[model samples]
Structure formats: C-alpha cells, structure tokens
Target: MIRPSSLIFAAALGALAGCATTSAPRSGAAVAPYRDSIDLAGRIAINYSRDGKRESLSGKFTWRQSKANTDVSLISPTGQTVAVINVTPSSATLKQSGKEARTAPDLDSLTTQTLGWTLPVSGLRDWLQGYATAVDGKRFVATPANDSVVTRDGWKLDYVSWQDDAAAVPQPKRIDVTRIALGQQVDEMAIRIVIDPVAQ
Candidate 1:
C-alpha cells in the first residue's frame, strides 16, 4: 500500500521551466541551495498512481519564482473547483470554495494529509540546478546528469532523467527521479515530470 507521505515526496519530482539556481553556499551545504527563477504559467498535466487508484489532475498554474509565493488552483474531476492557494516563504493562505483564506505556517502538514501531496518545492530547486540527494546502501545510478549524484547521509540517487539545457522550464525535455531503498521496506519509487514551454 502506498502511503500519503510518499505522495508528499512525489510533488518534489516535477521539472521547472525558466528557473535559476544560486552558487553553492560560501561554506557548508545550504538548506535550500537549488534556487532557480522559473515562470510556470501554462497547461500543466500531472499523472500519479498510488494503491491502485489513478489520479489525473490538469490545470493552469503559474509560479514566477520558486513557487514560494504564487496563486495555485486545483480543478476537480467533476469540473468543480476544490481550492485556491496562495503561498509565501513565511506562511501560506488558502481559500476553499467561497470560504475565507486560512493563514498558517509555511510548513503545514495539512497538504500532505488532506491532498495526499506535499507543497512542491525544495527538492526540485536542488534537482533543477543539477544537484542530487544521497541514497544510502547498495544503490545504483540510473541517470547521471553531471556524473554527480546528490549524496545526503549516504543515499544514492539520480534523476532518472531531466532537461539537459540551461533554460528555465516550460521546455523541460527530461525529468525523472529514482530512489534506492537500503534499510527501508520500500525499495524504489520512480517519478516522471514534464514541462510545457508553450501551452495554449
């Protein structure tokens, strides 16, 4: 059975268009090193399957920067509107239906539990800049962009694929994620992300 936390992690897999990254921290590894300025405005489609339930979510989203502060909306299967979200670095305000917007901490767990997904950020920021996260124990490299896999705490990971260009998203030709499970019960999870530079 697929867990919800896993879904939260899934949000971290999409590729960004028109994004930018900053130089490595002056000293020591930075918390949010992957900094890219991408304009995510277009018809974005995402497909995810968990526990045998297939979910198809398609809509228009625009992220001027790192998705830190932007307007996001989710379209329901029945052509109904579910929610509208406004996020910022310090906090997040959400408006559902005709209700008022609720302001909460930036790190709200409600998203992962209620939506079966996490706020999409961070990981992609790092990934877009060609950085990798570590995967501990007996792991293999699936797709190496810079011959460097992000090694965090000893986990071996590689973007199964991703855009090989320096261009910010919308035209992300390649986007994939692979995780090697060492001491965990789950062995692996594969995620694919696509960006449409020109969407009508």
Candidate 2:
C-alpha cells in the first residue's frame, strides 16, 4: 500500500497536471485566452481531505500542451522535484520522487494506481479554463463575470476566484473540487487548489 505522504504527493501532482505547461507569451504578442489554448506555469497549494483526514501540500508546476501531447512537472515547496507526468494520445507516464517511473494507458489510470483514487485529469483541461467538459449529465453554472461551478461524472468543481492580470483575461486563482462515490456507504474526497498566476 502507498503511504499517506506518498499518496498526498501523488494526489497533489494529479491535481497539478492539467493546468501545468508553457512559457509566458512574448512581449507585445497577443495573449491567447486560456479557453482557446493554454501553456501555463504557476505555483500551487493543495489541500485534500478524505473520510475526515486532511493534508496539505504546496508546490510549483509547469504545464505545456500542444496539439499532439502534454507534459507537466510538480516541484516541492522547498524546490525539490516531486513528479513529472507526460500524456499522449496513446499512453501516459509518471515519474515520482524515489519511485520507479510508471506508465499506463491514461492519466486517470496512472493517478488512480499511485494515489488510491482517480483525479479528473481529462475534465480538468476544461475546468482550468473556466469551461465545462462535454460530458453527459454535466451541469455548469457561471456568473456573467466568469466565476463558475461545474458538476459531472461524480465530481464537483467550484471556481473560487480569478487572478487580476493586466494584459490577459483573468484566470482562475483558486478552485475547490470534490468527488463522491455512492454505495452502501458514501465515500468522498475534497481538494482545494490555490494557484499563483503566471504571465501567460
């Protein structure tokens, strides 16, 4: 079984994966809206709770995405490396601190194995952009100013706030997410993310 601390690291990295990537746009270049495309780098603080147990982790992350693939890295608060994840159409790979690199068919499967639960890696790409994924049963609500909430496929996302960048459209600075599983007994996981916006 994975240790709780390792699970925390894995979960933190999983949460960081989709929003990490890309350098800032060049000076004088038009800033592409996040909803159109994203290449972002930022710092993140993650708080997670399950069954009444809570833990927190802080880190830096870089997320780069292109038409063909995506890559993300999570760095510890003290500047040590935590994990790296790469995703392609056919496969995903995760390299964690002090562990053998592992590969899986997809990001969800890889994170589920490493973290003891799955994160919404696929949906997060849209969630990070203040948009909802095109999944059945999904419900999304947004304010005229762009703050939003989304529920789909057993997960709920609350977009708490946006950064006040001068040149580009505001991007999410904090989000709270929860996943619920139904059965004889309900199981739930809660995650809170605090992001420090980058130039892009």
Best by TM-score: 2
lDDT tens digits, residue span 52-139, model 2:
8776666677777675577777777777667777877787787776778988887777878776677654556656655553224433
**On residues 93-192, what C-alpha lDDT tens digit does candidate 1 reach at each position?**
5556555555555434435434545533334444434454444322222233233353443333333343344433212334444443454423233444
Which parts of model 2 are misplaced by more than 4 Å? Answer: 1-4, 15-37, 49-52, 134-146, 165-168, 180-187
Instruction: Supply the TM-score for candidate 1.
Output: 0.48
Instruction: List residue ranges in candidate 1 displaced over 4 A.
Output: 1-36, 42-60, 66-83, 99-102, 112-122, 128-171, 178-180, 183-191, 198-200
User: Candidate 2 overall Cα lDDT vs. reference?
Assistant: 0.59
Give the per-residue Cα lDDT of candidate 2 at 169: 51
Q: Single out the weakest 10-residue window by summed lDDT for candidate 1.
A: 10-19
The TM-scores of all predictions, comma-separated, are 0.48, 0.70
- How far is each candidate from the true structure, as Cα RMSD in Å? 8.1, 6.7
